[model samples]
Target chain A: MSSIIISENDFLKFKEYFYRKTGMLFEDSKRYFVDKRLIERIEATESDNFRSYFNTLRFEASGDELQQLVNAMTVNETYFFREEYQFKCLVNSMLDEITHKKKDNSPIRIWSVPSASGEEPYSIAIYLLEHWSGIDKWDVEIMSSDIDTKIVAQAKRGHYSPRSVMNLSKPILDKYFIPQGGGYQICEDLRQAVEFSRVNIMEPADVRTFRNIDVIFCRNLLIYFDDTSRRQAAEMFFDSMKAGGFICLGHSESMSRISSLFRVRKFPEAIVYQKPLEAL
Target chain B: MAFIKKQTSQVINEDERKTPRDFNGLCVELNHEDSKVRRWAVRDLAEQLNASSVLVTRLEHEDDASVRTAILNALAKLGDTIAMNGLVACLRSEEAALRNEAIEILKELPYEVEPIIDGLLTDADSDVRIFAVNILESLRHQHVEQWLIGVIEKDPHVNVCSTALDLLSEVGSELAIPAIEKLKARFPDEPYVCFSADLALKRIEEGSR
Candidate 1:
């Protein structure tokens, strides 16, 4: 009849277990945040205490509860200029370096996967147009994909609610979008700039065509996958990239934890991972 | 030429076949000179339920790391008995990279690897037995604690027992307490084994209360 209390011991136990499983560590300051979610999960699962719920989380054959806990713990949102520093790095540091090594007039390729509601791909288009000087000198192709055809369709539509574009400046918005129905419809240039496709990165057939990509923003997607899936995804991305091409993950996600393929490159704007220039 | 609008997505349409994609053809591509061709062959072969036996043969000689990784992923995706056996063979590989990669892949395969884990734990090589305990660290099965207990209780090698004992301190409960005590007694002279077993016991006691 009573709710369970998460003791200090339980907190320590769960913290270590969660960190090992998900590679996300909770500091003492995050105790309230972690415990609130743990108790919520315990209650939701109808388990009397943290022990039973944790046992279910740890040993559940289907691993569904662990995924549920992951969903509860992580924030999933999409917006223009979300983690804007990475985009700044893309324009200031990454693209310049990519172009410096260029020997031909081939177009630069950028991929934003899980094109969630179109914020990320369109944001990349805006960044290159407004921030990068090389946009006029070099041709760029921005291609985005998501596993869900519905989301891919929504992305191609190039429409966004106000919250999705809250981070954009007035000039950037004016230059790129038209105010429509209290929201914004991205201009035809930015919409047509990105090629949207339905792609499951996990499937070999789906990803085989994604060859010679120059930059990839695979932010926050690998966290949901199991270790094998994560490694497989990394392998697929490695094959997809041009030698020395860069990848940007969510700030909290580390490529080192997922795979040994990529070399970590520390730029002033952000840290990104790079495929080796002479990789075989 | 900035943002050149393509009339159609060429990538989606044009995947030129370097080799025929039939079952037998994919198998032959495994021996292809170009590693990328071989890698694609491995990826496509993952769809074939019977590709494991063909893949296992290539795992031994695949020299390119990327291509080898693709083979490992395909093998693990199949995860049938033959595939699992091929992975177990990798534990004995001369290359540490391949062996460690095999361990990581095996950790992903709780169901297929479960029946063979006991044999791995009792493998003739002490190093292989130690690797088996390492697999238990992330098996995500209820039997992991029991497997660790079995290692500490029956494994003759001190290092193997020590590896499992270190894990038990984290995952074991009161069920493992008695074995923890006996393990400390079993290796009275080995400092790490004694310390780890005691730590496991203390943690178990605190946890149970």
Candidate 2:
């Protein structure tokens, strides 16, 4: 409701409440964004007031409703191959080194956190299949996780709106996705390649369950977290990754502000974070 | 008669002697260094059903995760109001992890937790209030909408107001229009609140229509 005036004190409380729950910082500059979502929920619940609703959110056990609130607040605007350079880097250099370093034919694990409706992971699968020539010899395991159950469900179904695939070349689209209804459904083989799970990185328990990740694609999600949350998240990533693992973040995000746990590795194509093999 | 008494004594084993049967003994066992002993004590305490206070206290200081979990299970099984108290204390905690864990426990017994919901709503800490409201989110009773609306009109906290309004938007009727309009009037500078109230009013109008 445009008329719902949130006082500065209330805004601060919301900021704290949201940060504690989701670890995402709602800064003063993002007031408009936060306010719009908060208003929508206020109306959705039909609560006579804000205080009670906050109480409900704080104490609710299932976390389903809070997840719904998070989903409403977040904007997942992603497309296939949104950043071309990263894919190029992955195909040209990263894979060669990773594959060469392997003693046996152990599967290379790639994690895509906040996989946002399946596009990114599927894009990865497609890229690996098309560009990486040695796919037959090595096993490629992709695990994708998102906080939003609704989005995760969408990711599992492997159907895409035309807008989601706008960046894909026609040949790639013809080979990988089958045209069904108005949107294209990803082929069964590619769909099955990526495993999807609902995970919130803010929760320590949830992050601890993930282990031995070779590479993590956590692009664009860190910008939402506060400094403390970002550090915690960075540590979680570091813990989850195997030694010599690589982390690719959004172009805007840097690990320096969050933590020094990850070392900056400047690749010709993109800057990424790496867990040193020598360091614990 | 002496020979028969000696035979009875011989039949009585050390295992039975060691196991805690009384409340005092079990309470002592709860603090045992060995987790298995503590777990056994927790389970037996649940069977006793009257040792809820001791179990709740042990749940607070218990270092072993399994032992703490066992204590929680025992308290839940006891179904005493004391268990509810333990959970409410967790709601008051500053630690989000503990608060979340308490919420999970309280979620199992929504009916038992209903009475304290109001107290939690009025808690000094905003986080506590938020957690209390979260407990209410699971309940879809007829009175829940009224309770939420009440919070909207009375609660001084903005997060609380926003939370209640969010619930009201889903559960409110045309009757809530006046209160929403009043909310809009109260905060002319808050465009988001104003916009939310306007939207809620529209939804109410639409639902009535």
Candidate 3:
């Protein structure tokens, strides 16, 4: 029951600032939703008004408040086959092109980062099994990483809440998962198929070992990083990739905003970025 | 299963990492014949506090775009006086890409860049002044609108004022309205300025209401 009111100008200020900091843009339709969250954060941070809260959000050295705001604003929940079109892109377009262009029969490598409890890497495995015909022909390496050790451990455990697996059809669920602790436990094969490691993508040492990657699913994570970190992340990925490798960002995130190193590649399933074939 | 595990333990062979890894070795490698070797040296150099001046020197001669990027990131990581001044020097470089790269790094270092921004704005080089305004375009400092107002109010170059005015359109407020109105009169013959200033003025008036 505080009397803090967000004026029209205040909302505009917050909207532009938030969009610039994080790539996520809130439309006019999300105004009520945005304002409510802003008020909640205002109250939580004990700021006198929107202006003070915004100042701290922008200038706070630790950047905890901005991170908190990103978490509150973004729907960060991950599930099986989330943004599955990119998987379709993988099976239909990316893998085919990769296998064809590859001179040697080296394993095609795929990296999924911010493993976020393994749904994505697991989903990639499941998608290749269910949809990709070349799964039988080519050797594929799937590596998944997360900044949080706890999340990395959780990802390796391969357990999922009911909500996490809600997108999976019952038949696929039955085939790939077992009921455990009133939740779904991913089968041993899928878990073993992926190599999960703890990695802070920002730390060069953590990511230096991930090299020659072919397709990278780095969705929904860069939106949380500040501008410099995002560019550095792009640079790290650029170095990690082989020439002509593909990168799939979150639907909202674009390499165009981050750096000019990658080329925009449009596929029927989803648009992706590519390290130019000529780049060393 | 076609899906393999633990297959990539980096492609870099242990024997290939034979470059001397100490600070002096990295400085020498920064001038190595291979661009990749030089890039790796830049990355490793970024970890050392004393490496900034060397990085600044290497960045001067590093022609490869990727190597330049690594050097820029390393300098930004150091975030010291030498690092900041080196980036400012890039702002005056004849190469457009180098200038743009410097702007990108400067935009992220508000605390480091804040002390130098006023001097940059008032610098004799109009293009350098324009680049300074470009840094202000995304600079998160609280005084961005004010700095931009100063440019529009005093910076004699039309293109520089016009650049400041363009950014002012997005971030300007009632405080900027007077300066922007005077800018329109100051550049009476400049059609683009008059139009955008009116547009910014209208938006501010509407937004404040």
Candidate 4:
């Protein structure tokens, strides 16, 4: 056990610095959680106290420690096929329509923004391969990105705990993953299918790197951002996609609240946003 | 398939089976003379478990524009790459609407359309090269600077080089200053290339500063 304590002023300093860096707002309700996570790092590094740790975070030349802190503080709760219906809609209708109009050999592109671990995008690959027989005939590019460099690195490792894959069917599990130690490691083929990178959606330059996306899966990420940052992210996605491209938010998130640029589309399985065909 | 866990002595059950879809009737409706029926059939096939093959085969011969669009959309939803060939061909379409539609799809497929766009960049038709440059302008990629610099240095078409310089003005860094200088040296006679190169050079210098 360690005896690291965080003062109120030091906590506020961390809050402000974190918000400035990642646009993730920490409210009063999350004080205990944030304080504890920060203290863990202070003790691990043998720092004097929270104030000194704050100084290191703010003035540090390298962003590596700050990223580790982000990995510690943020909640990366996700699983394969967490929202099966959204993927169902993706395979059932969206790809069909996009491929129908495509007469050339251009591939269809999908983005899983803040893809957390590799589960979501790997799930996407597995689902598409299983449900869509025409998958191999079309060039399909899947990009999975997250702001937390640690998590992105973990995603690239393609390892998952048992809980992260509970929602996956046994056949999918057996076919795509091999049990490793107590955890499961994704197969090489499925792992290679998704390209993983780090991106902060709040930053315009970062988001600008992703383009011409047909479908975007930004589930459960916006809820962590403030209203202003949320609006910026929505605008970024709107600008990043093609006219008539689809966006799937978390079950609790609504495009109506984020931005009015996207039209709400109701499918039999899920409700998503679409950049209208007329949109430039 | 059933797997028995030796340690736990438990048999993991396979997934619950789904009801089979009527792909045959949907296939028949796809060939209906009425474009409306064909369109509806295309949408219906998208709902089936394994109608992608039926949709891909029908898409090749479908004549009605509306039905063809429906089939394309359906095939896209099915995640078939067969529609890509047709969509790429549309980039060369003389019809403005068809060409615009194709560009829309191609623009959304940055990674997949790179090769096709590369082919167009050096096409004999300067208009095609301009179109390729315009598409590259909107896309975001790590190698965009490299591609733009290549065009500015080597492409003989002033319009294409100007387009590349315009994009460089937005995304370029100090690394692009030399490329802009080279463009200026390459086409001293072209006023627009020189002007755009000046603007790009200024932007890159200001950014680096």
Candidate 5:
């Protein structure tokens, strides 16, 4: 079988189908990425061009092929402490706000949407354990999710490469991780703190399940979205957060044009948004 | 000779002495007939003498856009006036990617490159204009604050307008107060315009306080 050459028409068809099915719009620039990912499917199925490969995906024997397609399409680059200042704010100021707003010893729920390989949610878990006292008394839950099943499986393993562990401070590393052969495995305590699941942010079921989250760390994921999709995602984020809860974004991402629901907060090195208590 | 030190190796030879000059000679091998050799030389030169006037002068005229981009980036990293004309010439390139990269480099320079950047504000490419606005915002070049305010007042792109508004709020220039107030008066229904204007007013008020 020869390698399939992806044409513009095939790219458009895939883009339109994906958008219609999942509400995740892919722009014209992602043509290269789509071509690269789908060629593997074409090679595996011994089909030429994206049209036959896409047909195989639609009518495959097992559902796993479609899952692989979604997995290939989803972008999942993340690291622990990806945005340092936002985490600092969470540790320093946002914790106080969360504590003040919650009833004494009530469970504080946090979600890391598109959690990738689980570095982000685990980072939050470590933060909570280190800073917040009476952790056992407070029913703390960290819900970590990603659209890719493979990454979700990896996330559940709670293992990481040395490079991924770079952002983790020495103290945190020593406290929360155990030395595995080459990479470190998250200690049982941190691993148990989060519930890992495969969840596409564009799926209605996934969004509905992530309700009443006290804080959301959905950073860096919005840049891929078009304007309408971004607005829809913003609305979903707004719905997900509890009253007075915070939403941390990537350093470059801003809610300025997309949503008025979030009130932007300025810290020295970071910007975040808060869903107003009054609005809630 | 002043920069070089005498080695105490017992096996001193003429070829070894000539090796330094050979490496220097390979600098011209950068222009060798082989594309691979020329490419490697260009990359090596870019890494070694990023801002050296001689390297910058030579590489700025390279046929390859990738090579020219590397040169522009190296020049920006050096932040010297010697590379300014080359950077300025790049801003007018037909390629949006090249022009955008040049604008990004100019924005990083400490000196006021606002006049050049401000000219790009009206470029047909929205990304170029947006990046130019971002650079001005980062620099807090108050001279261009009015230009930004004009963007907020009149630019068709909401993202550009919002970016300008956000920057103006951050800079908290008193001159922008009227523009913000005017935007508020005209676009009362648009939540972003109102929100940005209010934030700017709040910032100005807080500054006075």
Candidate 6:
């Protein structure tokens, strides 16, 4: 066992640095989470103490370690169809608009901005396959992205443990996923529906890569950001969407407080927004 | 079906058959010609069983609308983000009912819904637009304030504009005060906007006090 003891000052330093770099606000109460995750990092790195690990993180490297630090710090607790109503809205309302907006040969694009562990994007693939009959008529592309490279790699594998399939229905299980030795593998068709990549929501990137997206599903991940970061991230989503494109959020997320470019729509239990047909 | 039968002998008794594989055979029934079989299979597979590759594949190819809806519902119950892209594709179906069902599933996962909500706001269908607004209000989102203000400032539809005003009042933040002031200045004839502005101002004063 690595005898790495994290001090209060170390926790504070990480909190401040993480807040500054990633805009993830960690209060004093999160000392335990910080200490626990960093201790694991220290053990993995084979460092004897917290000071050496902290020093290496601070000085002996570029920003690569920062990502592992952030990954260790982040809580990636997510599951398939975690919120049922929102997916209903995506299939019911948003899909109709995309179908209406598409030209005969135009490819419909979708970006899952924080496509954690591939579940969200794969869920989307399952929805498309189940509902849309004229699949070959449209060129459909689903781009699933995340900031954590480790999670991105894991997501790309398209495999899940038995525990990970707890929420999945048997019919859906039998249809879209195949059983591997100890885990489940998403079917090739659903797996092929989306292309996964590593992306930081906060950093500047080639928006054109996500261009012409008819809809984007960036659910639940924004709560980790501060107000300014949220605003900036929302703007990025706005810029990335095509005219009259749609954005779907987590059940608890709303744009009412941050942006003016989108038109808010309501369903009984779901909320979706659309970019204006023209620029705001 | 074969896997389940082979594994059943490993179980000591019928009551002890709790593994996810017990429910594995339903995916074949999900696409059967009989609607009842398909529906039953979907229900059993989606609610009780672990995700199976075969079932997901069959449901993905099932031609019947009801069967498809059942499959989507089952996927939603599973909450697996892996199916998100497919669910998103389902949102583009020509049938309004099918599309609506897909949106309903997306609405349940707020964390996964935020980025997609912005795209949904500009949908040509008024009902879809309204659904986006309701979701935003529930999420207490700060990002939509600016867009809501713009809607109030210029949306051709009266209901859309009014909904924007209502949302601004509900948010009750100082950031909206400027937008409300502008609405009051430009849309002076619109009493609802004026009323909302006044109410927001009153709320701001009370908060400060």
Q: How many clashes in each candidate? A: 0, 60, 0, 28, 0, 151
Q: Please, what are the lDDT tens digits per residue for candidate 6 over residues B81-136? A: 54554565555556665565566556445555566666666777655566566545
* Two-chain complex of model 4, DockQ on C-alpha atoms against the true structure: 0.01
TM-score of every candidate relative to the true structure: 0.93, 0.45, 0.90, 0.44, 0.43, 0.44
Q: How big is the RMSD of model 5?
A: 26.8
- Candidate 2 lDDT: 0.71
The order by descending lDDT is 3, 1, 2, 4, 5, 6
Highest TM-score, which number?
Answer: 1
Off by over 4 Å in 3: A1-13, A46-64, B7-11, B14-16, B169-178, B189-209
Which parts of model 2 are misplaced by more than 4 Å?
A1-75, B1-209
2 against 4, candidate with superior DockQ: 2
lDDT of 1 by residue, A122-227 (tens): 9999888889999999999888999999999899998889999999999998989999988999998788889998899988778777877899999989888878
Off by over 4 Å in 5: A1-77, A134-137, B1-209
lDDT of 6 at B158: 54
- After superposition, candidate 6 runs with Cα above 4 Å error: A1-76, A134-136, A206-208, B1-209
In the range B1-209, model 3's lDDT, one tens digit per residue, is: 88778644555642224676899998888888877788778888888999999999988888777788888988998999999999999998999988998898898888998899999999999999999999987776888889999999999999999999988877776899999989999999999999999988876776555
List the candidate 1 regions with Cα displacement exceeding 4 Å: B6-16
Better of 2 and 3 by lDDT: 3
Q: Note the Cα lDDT for every prediction shown.
A: 0.87, 0.71, 0.87, 0.70, 0.65, 0.64
The sequence of per-residue lDDT tens digits that candidate 3 reaches over residues A139-165 is 889999998899999999999999999
lDDT of 2 by residue, B139-193 (tens): 5344566667767777777777777776666557766777787777776787777
Give me the overall lDDT of model 4.
Answer: 0.70
A1-280, model 4: which lDDT tens digit per residue?
6577666655665676576455567898899999889999887767787655654554343444676787787766788888899999999988887788676775577899887878889888888888886686787888888889998999989999999999988998899899998989999887777888888876745754566678999987776664335655775686577667899988767876655557889988899999766622
Q: State, as a TM-score between 0 and 1, how close model 1 is to the true structure.
A: 0.93
lDDT of 6 by residue, A145-218 (tens): 88899988988888988777788889999998899988899887676667777788766443324555678888
Interface RMSD of each: 2.7, 23.4, 3.6, 19.1, 31.3, 21.9
Q: Residue A7 of candidate 6: its Cα lDDT?
A: 62
Report lDDT (Cα) of residue A60, candidate 5.
44
Worst 10 residues of 6 chain B by lDDT: B1-10
